[model samples]
Target: MRGWIIYKQNEMLLRQEAYEIHRLLEVAKEENIELQVFSPDQFDLTVTRDDEKSILIDGKRQELPDFVMPRMGAGTTYFTLAVIRHLERLGVYCVNSSHSIETVKDKLFAQQILAEKNLPTPDTMLVKFPVNVALVEKQIGFPVVVKTLSGSQGSGVFLSKSPGEFDDLMQLIEATSPKANIILQQFVKASHGRDLRVFTIGGRAIACMERNSNGENFKANVSLGGVGKLYPITPEIE
Candidate 1:
């Protein structure tokens, strides 16, 4: 069987997890499976055929892969999702559905979905035009986090420890990025300085790690030079 792996090339710098794609491909090859990697811009969905036959592109006919592994990052956005949709139409199995990816990419939407499902998540607010910065402050209070609507690897995220700080940051952000909407959330004190990073696949935890930031940094992302240690997945984590 053949498979296609779609992912962002630049994400390798911030999140080295894309290296795992190579490992996965190696395993697939060991099992005698053919795999191909394509950058988001390389594929053209406009000329794609729907039948279970090969689609011609650039004078070459290529069969639709048996499955597609979407390791798309926030930067890929619409193009990545478009490729997934095209593959789905051609009967390709995606590791994570396009809708699921989209839902998770939107921080506010994800929080709402998790809350509706009775999943524990930090309190968050979404602000659009005519920003009600005061209302957000009254609700989530001080020491809140402000994150871009679409971001990953802890980029475009900021913490406001007080009302004055929050206002100053918001003003600066608004002046620089007038078109951008922000997601403000009440910081989870319990998870402060640390959090659990659990790799879950097929509803099962495979590997887990604990990340603890340095005393000077509040963000515990490994990319941020935070210390990490392998940890066993306990019932509490589940």
Candidate 2:
């Protein structure tokens, strides 16, 4: 059967999702499953006679694949999900269905879902316009963590110890990306400079690791120069 993997080409250089895609493709090739890369830039959507169509690369005319894997990044979110939904409408399977993926990709929304499911998570608050920095400081207290609503690899995460510091940082961020919205949260002091990196596939933990940050860094993301040690998954992780 034929399948396509869709992902942002630019982010493939450093993202772990890219590596996961490569591994899946390698396995597919070994198993004799037809696999192909479907980049967003290589296709255009059109609707004719109440039927949707995609114009693919190399000027080839083709129907949708048997399945699609969306490894898209934040930048290509809307288009990637649109394509995935289109494929689903055409009877194609998607690893994470568009709606489910969308829910997880949204940080605040995901936190809410987890909270509803009684899963433990850091206390978080989504903030928009008319934000009162003083009120936020009073509630979450000093040394709070701020993050953009949509970011990966700790790109938009920041630690602010004071209202003035938070304002300054927000000013800088606004000057750069004016459209950005953010979330404020109580920093997990116990988890300071460390966290568990658990990889789950098909609802099972496949790989696990413990990551510790370098000196003075709070984020333990490997992309941010943190060191990681492979660990066996305990019952808690599972």
Candidate 3:
């Protein structure tokens, strides 16, 4: 089988995870899986009046891979997902379908969908201009999680520990970014700045890691200096 991994080339190279990538490549080679890597920026899409489409990567028309795994975290969402959608039109299967990924990428939308389905989700309130600090407090209480519409590695996510903090953060955001989209989410106090990071593929979590904020921050994000420890997948995690 042949597969493609779509990733940000420069970022991954800078992170120096080449050894990890090489190990995966070696395993794939042994299994007769032809896996190739392509940066998201390399693709150009062409659409025609006849409702036909083709792609040019590096200025050359390319053959479609059997499967595609987009490794993008938070940036270039629309562009990369567009390519994934386009590939789907050509019958290529994405590890996570473009539609599903696109839907879940929007924090508010995901919550709304989950709540509608009666799925367990944090209580959240989407803010409009002139955000009501009192209403936010009444809905989510103090020490709430405030998250921007787009963020990764816990960036743009803040914890408002008090009513005053919530007001200040909301007012600052309104002043600086009048049109910023944000949400106030109820904090789960029991978690205590720690969470399980589950790595899922084909709908099963194959590996897990526990990330702790190191008692320095409220967001236990690896990019934010959180310590990680390999963990076992448990029934609760599933």
Candidate 4:
């Protein structure tokens, strides 16, 4: 079996050990699978007569892999998505379909969809220009979780413990990125400083782990110096 792991340009080149790509390649090697890493820029999609499609990677035509895993995180660009869509048209399976990625890329849209399906989700409100801090307090309450529309490793996430803090953060965002898309969620106090990270494949949960901030931060992302331990899958996590 063969697979391709797509990531950002510099990330793959640097071969960061902290990133999942390294671990994935190691596991693939143990399993006797040919797993190659490629940045989106390395791909060139060509469409010819009869609607035939082919790909050139690193200036050379190559056979498509059986599957492709895109690990571009929040930096997923339209061109990369187009490349993945092209791969799909060429009959290669994408671990996470492009449609799903597009849908979830907008945090508010993903939450709305989940809420629409009767799934339990935190009460969320989209942030707009001239944010109404009072309204957020009324709807979501204090100590809310503010997150940019797209982010990973807890980079764009914040814990606003008070209206003043929330307003201050909004002001900073306005001064820097006035057009940034963001959301405010009612903070889950029960999960403060810790959360579960679950990996799923083929519509089923395969592995689960707990991440902790050691009470140092509200975000428990491994990229943020948090610690992780194996966790048993429970009904709630499932």
- Give the candidate number with the greatest lDDT: 4
Model 2 lDDT, residue 60, Cα: 73
Report the backbone clash tally of model 4: 0
Q: Sort the candidates on lDDT, descending order.
A: 4, 3, 2, 1
In terms of lDDT, model 4 sits at 0.85
Which run of 10 residues does model 1 get worst, by summed lDDT? 8-17
Residue 121's lDDT within candidate 3 is 82
> RMSDs, each prediction?
3.3, 3.5, 3.0, 2.0
Total residue pair clashes for candidate 2: 0
lDDT (tens digit, per residue) of candidate 1 on 54-112: 54333466777888888876665787798787778777899888888888888888899
Error of 1 at 156 (Å): 0.5
Model 2, residue 18: distance off in Å is: 4.9
Q: Where does candidate 4 have its weakest 10-residue lDDT segment?
A: 9-18
lDDT of 4 by residue, 120-163 (tens): 88999988889988888899998899999998778888888889
What tens-digit string does per-residue lDDT give for candidate 3 at 19-72? 445666679899999988778888887755444434688798776777887767
In model 2, pairs of residues that clash are: none
**Candidate No. with top TM-score:** 4
